[model samples]
Every structure is written in structure tokens, then in C-alpha cells.
Target: MAPLHSKSHTSLGSRKSSIFNFIQQPPQPDVYYVGVDVGTGSARACIIDTNGIILGLSERPITRHELKANFITQNSTEIWNAICYCVKNCIRESGVDPEDVFGIGFDATCSLVAINEKTDEPMAVGPDFTDHKENIILWMDHRSVDETIEINSSGDKSLKYVGGQMSIEMELPKMKWLKHNMPGGINSCKFYDLADFLTHKATGSEARSYCSTVCKQGLVPPGVDGSTTGWSKEFLLSLDLEELVEDDFRRLGGIPDKNGTFLSAGDIVGKLTAKSAEELGLSTECIVGSGVIDAYAGWIGTVAGKVDNPTVSNKLDSKNNGTILTSCGRLAAVAGTSTCHIAMTKEPCFVQGVWGPYKDVMAKDYWLAEGGQSCTGALLAHVLAIHPASNELSHLAEASNLSKFDYLNLILENLVVDNKSRSVVSLAKHMFFYGDFHGNRSPIADPKMRASIIGQSMDSSVNDLAIQYFGACEFIAQQTRQIVEEMEKGGHEIDCIFMSGGQCRNGLLMRLLADCTGLPIVIPRYIDAAVVFGSAILGAVAAEEAVQEHIHKKGKSRRSSILETQRSQTSLNKVGSGVQLGDGQHSPYTAPTATASTTNMATLAYASTQTGSHHQFPTMTPMTEETDYFNQPPQKKPFSDEDDSEDEQTLSFGSKSNVQKGLSQKLGNLSLKPLTKTTDTSPGAKLWKVMEKMTGPGKVILPSDENHPDRKLLNAKYKIFLEQCYKQQEYRDLVDGVEAENIKG
Candidate 1:
């Protein structure tokens, strides 16, 4: 609720000044930028200076409507209001003069916002079509699963960019569902990805971001997939969504005859509108940058922090030695209600089940891939809520003034002490959890997958709850390993992970993640605010652009004024070798070289001229068998009595002595040691200078020793984890076969 972490250059001697006093104060010479992030549950705003040091941060919860199962919706109006509230509060808290706020950037969940074109009012997109208030289809909503299946069946070339499968969570599937279900069809409605909607709200520009369009709406960039315009008209026509192709795809952020302006992350959209400025308590001169999905913002916020490890830092710098830069090697895991694994590469890597190899999403000239888990923090919460000892654990945690997670971690440590075990991990030696309660987003890409738990007991003690919590954390870590492995198999050379989220606060999770993945986990300085901070970085870039524009214009005017004076003086008097000014110094003005605006304009012109034929879809390439692992049938294993009786052998919590014996047996010869330490060998140099300036250094947690005994245990457990995943598929196959036979009979 309070400012997460603030570093103020100005003295706080007058901190108690009223809001009016702060507004009336003269603008600071130093410029500030504001970043607004709209997550699933809340809207947050933070004000940062050029150095990317946060001065103030505030958040406000928005209303969510779950009208039915898997039908989550929100009101755009309420979300905007919450954003305005957070911005105003952030400014007031920071005591920053509104006029000094030169730019603002926004990032939100990749949800769909529908607006009526004629009235320019929020249009309903939900179970109750009459209720116009709920205009946003929340990103997590799965009401469009059937539509997703239908679209994926089209086998469009555009689907290749999204890992050969279109997710139901993406905007296109939701739009299809709305078209089929909504009264009057969606012809009169305009759809904006939530991030684009936020930018439009701020600056009144209908322009979209490449991050949103290319990643979610299946808009292939000009150079990729042999498309001229980003939109694939033939693909849309094949899917029977002709309304989107009409009006030059205007409703879907496409321009009629010309290529629409789809700005990259750092590009400016426009200046803030007067209405938006007043609402947000900022100046109208403030520029609005193109927005990105929240997770992409996290990638921007991290990946650039100075790594303390020399080995990793060297890889971040060298280009010739099989080493990739930070943008290519580092993966940003933005975890909150869910966790998104974002990585960028020099070329597109078509990883199956991952969301993208999207171009110009987070950074220019880089391809971005997004793999995610649909539920993580939410999964942990559900696990705790369903446990019988949850209330008791909560009460104990409250009394101790600790969070439930922290308290559980402490309980696990105590268990380790009492059992004389090497580490708390021993307590969960036999426990295993399959964490796909909301479904798997990556590697498997199956929405129907459910969660499973092994090694359960009738005892509902707090100790059992602690073990359950540990298993959940382990599941998150193991799933992360699985996602990383899939990405690597697809040709991504991931080095270390840059994680930013609420989950970073949980040390046990961090440790388990490092141990499970065998990669160092870099924690950003502002762990909880990294995504918002990344948005602030975009705002900073926009502000820098505005300043450059001002300088260019001022320089041009000064040169004009000086030239006129020089000509007048030369005509009046006889000069030396040349017309000399009074001070005998040369003019300081030089013509402004190609700025970002001109370069962008040139790019647009090129794209407009290169409008390739839309009638033909590009030749589709089949994914290799090894890379398309998700499509392959689960490997069959011979049934055995041991496999059938494995559940019966699970340790029961009813007896402490038996539990200890089971843990020891499962752990085998495992012995715990402190995490492995690595030393810096190369000269420390920053790789991403701009990002490093914005994000600063963070703590690094190295993985356990590769040769440790625990590695063997964890490796074996991971095998079991994979087995459980295949076991789920086997169950589904058996049931499906039964249904088919029944129909025949």
C-alpha cells in the first residue's frame, strides 16, 4: 500500500505539504515519468525520475465480474478510473510537480476491450450482453475455448508464429466467441487490447502496439511470414471472421489502404489529451508511449540489471564466442496471479506450445517468445485454501506477524531440525504435486489438464499443511524447469533467469527454482514493482524523445535567427575575410540528423509500398517431430503391480515415526549443503546500458552444486513429475476411447 521503495533526490523537508501546495510548486528542472500497470486485480502507478529510481508508487483494486465458470470480465471504465486514482495518488505521494511529468506509459493484461464505434462507449462482452458495464474480457477468461479450437484448426500460416496453436486467452478467439454469441454481432464494435486501450485513454490515439497485436491478435509483422500488412486477410476470411477484415481491419486496429501505425515499446503514441491530463493530475504536454502487455513490460524492467556473476556478465557482452547478450540469453519470469516466461532471441524460434516469436514486441530487431503457466500464485492460494489446517496456519501466522508462506517455511525448517535432516526439502521427499489446476499454458498447452497430488493422508495437521505448501512451491519450480527445457529444445540458449513478481519475496520458492532449473535466478531491485518499473522505462524513453524534439526545433529556430542577423550586419559594414560575429565564435547549430520520428515515418512508407498479395497464404512448415513434442502421444510404459500399489505406499501423517522413516528412505543418501558460489572472472561491464540505468543491480541466487546428492533425488523426482503429466494424458485417452465405443454401440 505504501511506496514500495523510494529514492528521492530532493530533500523531504516539506513532505507535509498539501496537494494544492505540491501542484502550485514550480516545476523541477529534472523531468519525471509516470508508469501505469493494470494487472488482473489492480491498477498501479509509479513516478520515476530519469534515473529510474521510484519516488512514489500507489495501487487501487478494480472490480472483476465472474458471471460464470471461466467467464471473467471487467469494466474498462472502472479500470480507467482506478488508473487515474493511482496516478493522482502517486503524484501526491511523490510531491512532484505535475508539469515536470513529461511522459506517461501504460501496460495492462492482454485482455480485450470492446467499445461501440458510434457512441464511443464501452460495449458489453460477456454472459450478459445487455450489461454494457463489463466491457473487458479478462485475459484469464476461457469462455472462448471452443472458438480457439476452431481457429487453430484453420492451420493458418500466422499460427506458426504463435507456436502452431492459438490460445483461447488471445484476443482473436475471444472476438470469434463474441461474434457468434453476442446479439447484433460485433460489427459495430471496435476491439482494443487492454494495453492499447489504456494508451488510447491517455492520448486519444487508436494506434496499437506491436507487442499486443503481433502477440495476441495473430498480426504477422511485415517482414515475417511473407506478409506485407500485419493482418492476414485470407486467414480471417477462412475463419469466417470477415467483419474484422472489413473497413480495412479498422475495428482491429488496421488502417484502410495504408499500413496502420503499430509502434514498438519505446515509440511515442501522442501527447496526453487535456481530459486525460486533468483526470490524472498531469500536464497535457506529457507524452504517451506505445504500451506493451504487462509481462513484456517485466522483460523490459528486468534482463538488463547488472549481473554480479562474471561468467553470466561475459556472456551478456560477447557476440563472437557463442555467447548471447542479455536480451537473447536472459529470460524474464514475470510472476503474479500467473507466471509468464518471456525471452528474446535474434531470430525467430518456433517453439511449440509457447505463445510467440513475435517481432518488435519488447525490443526492436529481436524476436520474443512467451511461455507461461495459467495459474501459479493462484494455484498456491487454492492449495492453501483447500487444506484443512489452513485456518490454524493462518492464525499462527497472524500471531507471529508473518505471512502464511513465511510461516510455513519456518515450520518446514523446524521439521528439519526435529527430524535431524540436512534440509527442509527432505520433509517433502515423497510428496509430489502436479500444478495445472487452471491448465498448462506452455509445453503441453492443454486447458483441460487438472491438478493432482500424491502422498496425502487423513491427518489434517499444520505439519501436513506445511508439507503441502512446500510441494506447491516445488511444483512451480519444476514446471518452470519444464518450460525452460521446452524453450531450449526449440533452439533458445537461455543463460540465467530474471524474475520479477510477488513470488520473489518467497525465498524458499527462489531457492527451489534455482535448484530445480540449475540456473541462477536474478532478483530485480524492486521485486514487486519490476513490471511497473519497466513501464516507467518506456515512459522515460518517450520523455527523452520529447526532449530531443524540443532541442531540434529550438536549434533550427536559433540558426534561422542568427543567420538573419549575420546577413544584416554584413551588408552594413566591411568585414574581415568573412562576415564575423562580435564574439568570433562559430554557430553552435547543426542540422538535426534522422530522428526517431523520421525513421519511423520512413519505415511506415516502406511497409505501405511493400503490401504483398493477401490472396495467398504463405506455405506452412510442419514442426519437426522432436520440437512438436506436445502433439506426440505419451510414451507407454508397461503396467506393473508396483505402479498400481505406489499410492498405497505413500507416507501417512498419522504417525511421526513412520513419516520420518519414509522421508529418510525416499531421500536416500541426500545431504544438504549451502548453494554453490561462483566468482567473477571477467572484467565487470554492463551489457544493456539503458536497461541497466533503469533497473540497477539485484541479488543473485545461484543453483545448487551439480554433483550434490540432492541433484540425483531432484532429478528422479522430476522424472516422476513428467510421468504424472503423461499419466493425465493416458487417463484422458482411456475416457475418450470409452465414449467413442459407447457411441458406436
Candidate 2:
């Protein structure tokens, strides 16, 4: 591996060629895998062997120019040029013939790119569009504050899916801002997110990833009732940017597809046309994959599956505990310039201040909710680089022969050790850092907020550097805790924390996370290269090849597969018996491995519509006659002929301490708390019914304070969430219900 710090500031050197050692000849000989990742400053390329090893790696810096205080922009032509350079470098380094390369995949930051497909020219974004081709909007850009407020105020149903609010960082706000401010550019342009643009440019395909549209843009996936739609025509018309709803909504991304299902990347998307081939210095046969957002690629690479540890020998005993335990349950913070916390759920959840429940966005059949801060490590660097003590620290680091980050960490470590009474983890207690410096991305998608530092002193020495460093780390962890807390309130119960990205390597930061969240942190063995491997897997899958199989060791099968092999001879353990899935709902047909009885047949309520309908009951081995409900109606008749799926949230309560234990210790105390009492029957049932009446179809769930403890706590917490977390019309309605009840009484 190369040293942590690059010797020179320019580009990666000839070591790129040595990476070819990992390249494997494909079974079909013509098949290959490509992985592309776009970071805050550049786009990188990697070629991986079929076994998921890096064969070749290359990179080219992307051009990002700042126009104003918070405005960041990039040139599409420049980005494409960088991509071409990296691809050519990869082919040259690996010495792999382009024709032998079969599939390719890509992922980039969720930036916005605009172009005129007919003229194939860029449209202006601001007064500084001199490059004409510099029409791309960087993810870090935050110039549409008012636009975000307007969209949030409209209380669009699509907004609820994105945690009940909209932000300027997302594409719709930017699009609306563009149309209202620059009518000419809006008229002349066809809009595409940065990832969508790269894929379209490479393959001449317009398909968008559900990952991008559902997460960042206001594209709602098909719900349980099976209705699908994009930005509302009426809403856009009301906003006076109705032209976007024209052309059947071609400008923004159309119906989005799952990641890795589109045209494969390695096989010639369209043989590199002569013009493009000449510029890229590659054979016409080079293939390109449908690209993805950078963070999603990280999700594809690191946490998709196949993570194993020999030291972790114990298996979870409870049926339901195993699924959440075995799965990577930690918040994955893709920390670099910014930090994003990605959490997954078996069912789709609409958190009031979180990002998604985006369908099939990353892992197929799973929903994802992304919470994050706009800045973390990058903000720290930017702040420290300008500090007066930085010059002194740099001089000291040069003398000590250490990188600046290492130097700062060492100092903080010494201080923590000397004090003995305090730990670096507790630094945020004395000092707090507001997330608004780059703006908050989650728990509040408010961009108008600015970063603030509390408990600063006039000390301009090395200790100042240590304090700032410790403070920054603490601030990030607190922000992360806040996000996790919000997710829990929205009904997501996460246990461990999984970390990736370069920043995850920092021991201080990891310990800080552990201290704040009080959860064990799992850092995957392959950290930096996870995204590359993930994209390669996506490419492999798109090419009609099996990639999930590559996640395990050569002779080892995945947990599901292993269970299948043994199930015929011995009774297999069913998921969710001793373990809780929130509400009291359990799959009766599930077999238990421990001191529990197996239900005769499966009847699972509260399961996601997508997976529950088609999932086959897990068969326990040693076939015995048991009643099968596969084709039978449910045992219980309808209590009320009403669909209460929205109110069907179950509360699975694992002790806070249980989350910190090892597998065996953790599995000992699993308890199920089913808050299954229907609000329709409770005293608060009438109040909830009244509140339901106040809400219209396609409206959001709101809080009301009319009833006793249960309803009052719900409304108060929800009111605080809306007033302090994220505001929407639904929140106002909830508050209005509280007032209306007080007067009536």
C-alpha cells in the first residue's frame, strides 16, 4: 500500500502499473470489472479481478471553483475529461486489452449537472459561466436557501418521504432556483444529477438510479398501494416553474431503476466513438457502466455483505436477533469533506428529519435512510489550516517527520493521558461545534445555519490546536448521536456502528463515536477500497454475472446459503422468535434453534409489501407434517375493515446495555415489547381518529396533544421536532389539533 500521505501534491505516479497484479482472467475471457468513485475534489478509477481485488487504479482531479461564499461549481467538460484521463491511465497501467474488459461501474458525489442535449452545450448557472461548460453544481453548493424554504412550505407528499422536509442541497430546490433566476438557461437546459449525467454521457442512456432520485430529488418510489410519481405538476405549477412538469418530466430524472440493473459498464456501452476514443486514448471497445452517487457506491462496496471476522465465533441464539446482529447495523459515515450517516431498515420508514426509506436504492429489497452533516473532516482541515498555531505545528511536524493530522492526534493523546481525569471523547462536553459551518444535512436539512464554536480561548499555541482538534471530533460525534436519536424516535433501533472512508481510520474519532453512541464500532478490513469493490460488484451483476457469491471466502458459503445446506438434515432456526421486531408481530412458521416452540405455519404481519408477499417460508430440515398457511387466509378476521399499515409500527426493545456486549452476551437478554394496542380502541383512539380526519389523503402523519400521557407525549415531542427539527404543514396541523382540543375542553 502507498504511504498515507502523498509525497507530492500533483498526481498518483507509476505505482499505478503494479496494481495490475490483481487482475484476473475472467471465466469468459472477455469479462472485466470497472469501479469509478468521485470524491469531493476528484474522480478515481479502479479495475478489479473477478475475486474482488484491485487490478489497476488511477485518478484525475476534478475542477471545483467557488463563485461566492457558499457557491461551489464544476465544469462538466472538465469532469468528463478527468474521467477519460483516469480510464486511459487504468487501461495503460493494467495492460488489459479493452476488448477483454466486460463490465464497468461508477459512483460520484450527488452533484447536479445541466446540459442542452440538442446542442450538446452547457447552460449558465450564474454570472460566472464563462467556461460555458462549467454548468455542473457541486454537492457542497448552497445557494438556494429560499428555494428550499418554499418547497418545504408546500408540504408535498414527496417531501415526507425525504424525512418531511426539503433542503437547498437537494436537486429540486436547485432546479427551482435555476428556473426562477435564469429563465433563459432553464429554457435551454436539460437537467441531470452529476451521476446521471456521467452515465448518460457514457452510454447515451437516460435511466436514473432510484438511489439518487428518491434520496436527493423528490422522486417517490411506488408505495404499498402501488402508485408512482415524480415532482407534482400542480406543485410546480403553483411554484411558477411548471415547465419542469412538461415533457412528461424528462428534464429531471424519470422513473428510477435499482442500482446495477441497467446496461453493464465493461462491455462497450456504445463502442467508444472515434471522437471520444481519440480524446481518452483508449480502444473503441472500452465499456462504461451506469454510474452511481459516491456514497451509494461506498454502500455498494463496504456494507453490501460478505464482512467476516474469525474472532467473532459466537452466533446469535434468537431467531430475529440474528438478522439485525449479523447484518452491518452501524451508522456508516462516509467522512471526507463531509460526513453522511447511512442507516438501513427492513421496512420503509419515513423519519421526520432523516433522508429516506428509498426503495431498492442500494441493496435490492431493502430501504435506506441517510442522515449526515455537510462537513466533518473537511471542515476541521479548513478551520485548522487557517489557525495561527498551524504554522507552528507544521514546523514541529516537519521536525518530527509526521503528517499534520498525526501530529495533532499525538498532542491530543498526550494531553488526555496527562489529565487522566478526562478523555478526548468527553471534549465536546466542554466545547461544542455547531454543524452549520457547512450546514446541517440531517435531523434538519437547514442550509441557512452556520458553524459556531463554543468555549474558545485566545491561546494561539500548540494547545489551541489540540483543543480545536478534540473539539471538532467531539462535535462530529454529537451530531452523529443526534441523527441516530432522531432515527430511533422515527422507530429505527440500531445497535452497532460500522465505519468506512479515510476518516474512519482515525482512532480518536472512532473512540469518540464509541463514547457518545456507547456502541461498539466495526471498521471493515478493506476500508478505503470498499467503494471500488462495491462498484465492481455492481458491474459484475449488471453483466448477468453473480457477484454476491464473491463476498464469502472461497470455500465458505453465505449465512443464508449455509443454512439452506444444513436445513435438510437438521431443523433450521427461523428469524424472529425470542427476538422482537418492534410490534408483537412474528412469523409463526419460523423455527427456533433454542428453548422456543416453532409455529406450524408462517403468517407475518408488519412486513414490507415488496418482500413479505413473495418471501417463501424458511423450511426447517427433517420434514415433518405441519399445517401450512401458504395458501390459506390469516387466522384473525379484520378487526376493522381499515388498512392500518401506517399505524402498524411495532416497538422491539433491546436494552441499551445489550447493544454493547459481545454476541453471546448480547443474545442473552432479548425481549419483545409489542405496542400492538390499536389506537382505534384506546382512549386516544378517538383523538387519533379526529386527527386522521384533519389530514387529507396523501398527507403526512402529525402529532396531537388532546389525549392523556400517550397522545400528549407524542404530540409534544413531535411538535418540538417540527419547530426545532424540521417544519412542515403536517407539523402545523398537529400543533393546531393541540390548541383546538384545549379550547374545546
Candidate 3:
């Protein structure tokens, strides 16, 4: 291993041919991976083959305890149960043998899960009216707004990682809120980000993922006082929130808890304990991989194919000079209710209001920076729903047997003139909008700043609504443009856009984003609904790590060091009755040795000593280099007439992918292929020679009126109007309040 700190800085110096730490060779055909993704509203599971294909998928709605839209919470126990239900269903539906499954991975929203270690139960962070077991602090909750203001006032250096300002939505401010508001909740065991909690629940591993800790929890950055990694007690003390480390860093992170140690995204945490195997309906042998935040998972899943080779090749280039991909420079926009603008660069670039420069949080070795709109799809729906044209448009959609969004797109198509440069941009130019109704998450970390709409008309016609929708799309695109500019200013060479999440479905939004940003948008087909697959990637990686550990021991299959580490303190006598997933058998928590269900003096002494004065922080493995393909060009896969499959000729909604029941056709054929359109089939189809002039798959309409004077005027005038919004007295008060709070305290 190349030492701990070397892992943090991935892009430096010339080196020899070495295996990329994160890369995994294709496993045996029998091996499979299970991935679980717990988003804000749902828990989804996917069973995948070694070839990066989804074989089966299942999902269940996750319940949230809401005091309002801003105070969202969830039950830890319930989330786990939901995951179990989904995992079992996906595995059963996929018809894969339980013994074939070798690994599993997880990704969850960056919510906080407060639990009582003494009882192994969740504790409350909210009012008493509801169940205390609903102990999660949802990522969207804003109850800690005041606390965030207070922390930002401290002006700590840690704030730089979070864009020089902390949002109420982040963990530290929420930690402050919990400490002050719910005093009883402070006497805790472990406070886990939802993702890490899932890993702990599954494998009894006490390690946290680098994704959640560095990105969400404001962990002390690399090289702080020669520490390898963990919370910064100094920074925590600076905020007067020292309770996070009351237990020798146990609550924040101590040796006592199995999850207290931190693991980078691909590390193996441990094997599934018998209890977790029973709940998940998988074998106890299933290796549990370290988890990640949902958005980061999406980033990995979307860009991995572009950055790394997915095929099984044993060629010279595959080792020393594999495809060096430039996928890192491409920004991934996970657009749904909110849109996260995620970018990666070779080194740290801190842009105020944009959170990160987090080292290797997502892409390996590269620093990740994030910016976002507090609202996107949500804001669009909010304004449109109130318009009078909404009902009429809905009725038209229903009458046409199409969805409202589809109907709206059709209406937009009619509004455009053939061969005119005036696409949706022409109609929306008259109206300008700034979306921060839910508070800006990035490029301006101002939660107090509300949204502004400068253009509206008395006309409530359907066309008006459609035009407004177009304008919102344009405005959101403009916001994205501004974020890109700030990132460029901060030294990230971002040009191409990688889109993911639900918003990628909107063809119009995709086109406008490309035009506004003057960048090509690469929408990986699987990236849109990819959180679960990303988790599976992590699982495969963990299994790879375990394989290496075994190899180092000269091919011993004895329990992995990580697994032995977790159960090392527990005596063999404590083996409780456990359910076995395979062949419907029964067993104990561990089959390591004989069982009598008794504890000895040595066990107690060991546990205490590990957590007491003599305790030592877990040593991290030296950082391994991430796959070196992100800066390489995508291999040009030329299209050929022979590529058309006869089977695809009649693919439709009613068609069943599994009607043929081929293994490749399983789970509705979730493909990782790049989405492209046939250039000859468009409006320029007849003139094939002339159509070669077109390069992009999407019609950007930039050629039409390339230098329209109106576009310049709109851009300049809108810039001034935006300046005025921030310069207004109300905006100034919001800024002043942030300043006053920090200065006074």
C-alpha cells in the first residue's frame, strides 16, 4: 500500500503499471450482486449480473414522518424492513439461486439516524406526539435554520468544504439543533448518516462511508494534525457542539462501534450476519460493501462506463494504458425535485455557495464539487398547477390518452416553426425566473433567499402555460449556466454535461440545457434511474477487496479480517438463534466455534479497554489509485446497418422483455447503452448527403439566428435584473442576518 495520505491526492507524479484499486475483473458467471437504494420516498433493490446488467428489480415506498414539508423524518426500523422486503422480492423475482449471490451494496439519502447503542433501538429527534422510533432527520428538513446561522458565524475553516457557508440541511447545524432541542437524544450510542446506518444494520460493521462522512458530516479534512481520517474535535469544539465526541469519539466515531471506522466507497465492510441474512432473505455469506450517499452513487453509475472499460479484456492497453477517460470533467446533474450540479476535477476548487472539493468522495482520487437548485421539477409543478391552463391542459391530455407532460411537449412542437432557429427559447425569452423558492443549495448557499418571477401575463391560456413552462426550463438552464461559470472560475474545466435522475425524461429541458450551456449532454440510458445499480457496483468492489485479502493470506478462506474484527469481542457463547437463508436451515449468529450463550470476564475487559483510555483508532488501508480513464475520450462506436436486431422491431410498452425468457432478457432488459437517434430519420432524412452536416443527436437549433440581438439583450438585461434581486432590501437583510449572527457570537 502507498500510505494513507497518498490515497487522498490521486493525481500526482509519474508511476508504474499498477492495478487500479477500484477496478474488478469479471467474476464467474455464477456470482451476482445485490444493490439497495433508499431515496427520500422509496427503497429500491436490483439484482445484477457481473456484466453490469440488471437482472431483476423491485421497489417499495418508504414512509416519512413529516411535521411539515421542511421537517421530514423516518423510522430506522421501518426503512430496514422496507429494504428487506424489496431485496427479498427482487431476488425471488429474478429466480437467481441464493447461493450464487456473493455481494451486496447500499446507498441512502444523507439523512441522520439517531440511535441508542445500549438498546440497539432508534431514539427521537422530533416532538413526542409521534413514535420516537422515527428517529431520522431527513436531508430536506430545515428546522435547523437558526442553528446553521449560528455555526456559519463561527467562521471555522471546515466551512470551506461546504462552500464557506453551512446550510440547515447539512448535518452539523442539525446536530446543533438536536443537541439543544432534544437533550435526551444527546445521550446516544451512534449517530449515523442513513447510508452508513444501512451498512451497520446489515453486517454489524461499524465503518462509515467516505461519501457520507466527507460530503454531508463536515468531517475534518485530510492532513489535519497528521490524522489519517475522522471527525475534527477542534472544529466541533469551535462550534460549541462538543457532545458529538463525548464518548472518546464513540458517538461521532470511536473504536467501540463497528461502524466508527471509515471506509472509502469500494471497501468491504463485512459479511452479512445471520440476522441480516434472514431479514434480507439472502445467504449469510453475502459480502456487505461500504455504502454511499444516493447522489454520489448516481454520479458513479452514470459516469463509470465512460471512464472505465466494462468489457473483459486481457490486452496490454487494458493494464498499463487502458482507455484514459475524460468522464470526470463532465458534470452530472441529478435532477428531480431538486437538481444537484456535481463536477469532478484533478484538484481542489472551492467556489463559495458550492459545497465540496471533497477528495475522492465520488470519482476516485479526483475532488468533487457540488452546486444545485433547491427546486427544479418541484418548482415547475408548483407554478403550473396554480395556472388556470393546468386543468384545461390536463383534460386535453386525458382526452388524447397521453400524460400531461407528453401533451405539453406536443403542444410545444406545434408552437415551433419548421426550419426556424426559434425553438422553445423564442417563446420563453420574454419571461425570466430565478428559482430558490425552497432556498438555494448551491452557487449561493442562501436558504433565506426566496424565488423571483419577473414575467407573467393576464392570459391564462394553455399556450401561456406551455410558454411559462418553457421559460422555467430556460431559467433553470440559465442557473445551471451560472453554476458552470463559477466552477470554471474556480479552475474546473467542465464542458460536457452528464444528466441523470427523473428530470432527464424531459426532452425539451435536455435540449435547452445543451443550448444554454453550449455543451453536449450525454444521457446514459441507465443513469436516470441508477442509484440501485450504483450500489451494486460498490458491492462488486467490496467482494473484489475480500478476494485480495484472501490472496494475501496465500489463499485461505477463513473469515476476512474485517469480519473477524467485528465479531472479535463477542464470545462464542453469545450465539443467538438465527435463521439461515439457504435450504431453509437454522443456525446461530456465528458458527465459528461451540456455543453456550455465556460471556466471560476476558470479553468484558476487552470491550472496555478498546473503548477506554487505551483505545486506538482503526488503521486505514493505504489509498489505492482510482481507475485512470476519466480524462480519455469515449471510444467511438460507429453505427452499422447490421446492428439492428430483429427482436427490437416491435418493442412497445405492452411487449414483455421476458416473453422469450432468455437470461439476457430478464428484468425488462435494463441496458447501459448510450442513447442516440438516427440522423437520417429526422426532418432532413431524404437528403442524406446534406444531413451528414448534423452531428448532435438532439436538435439544439443554435444555427438558426446564431447571433440574435435579442438573445444578447435578454442575457445582459437578465443579469442586471438578477443583480437587483440580490441588491434589494429584503435580500440585503438575509445577507445581513447571516453576517450579524456570525459576528455577534
Clashes of each: 0, 23, 15
RMSD values for the candidates in order, in angstroms, are 20.7, 20.4, 18.3
Model 1 TM-score relative to the real fold: 0.77
- Candidate order by TM-score, decreasing, is 1, 3, 2
lDDT of 3 by residue, 552-611 (tens): 564344534433454565422111111112322211111111110111000111111112
Per-candidate Cα lDDT values, in order, are 0.68, 0.51, 0.58
Using lDDT, give the best candidate's number. Answer: 1
Instruction: List TM-scores for all candidates, in order.
Output: 0.77, 0.64, 0.72
Better of 1 and 2 by TM-score: 1
Candidate 1's C-alpha runs over 4 A off are 1-28, 255-259, 309-311, 314-325, 548-689
lDDT by residue for model 1 over 1-745, one digit each (tens)? 0011111111233221311012111112335788898887678888865445566677766778898999999999999888888888777666566655768889998999999988889999979988999999998798988889889899898999997888878899999999999998988899999999999888888899989999999998887768887898899888779999986788888851374678878678898876887788776668888899999889888887654444555566564332224467789998877789999888888888998889877655668899998888777778788899988976786666555665676677667656766556767888988989987888888878999999998979998998898888889999999999999999999888998765665667777787889987876655567788889877876666454443456434332354356456543111101111222221101001100010111110000111221111122122233322111221122211111111111111111111111110011110111111223222111113335555654545667678866666677899999999989999999999999999999
Q: After superposition, which runs of candidate 2 have C-alpha atoms over 4 Å from their true positions?
A: 1-31, 68-70, 128-131, 183-185, 224-226, 253-288, 305-330, 363-365, 416-436, 446-458, 546-745
TM-score of 3: 0.72
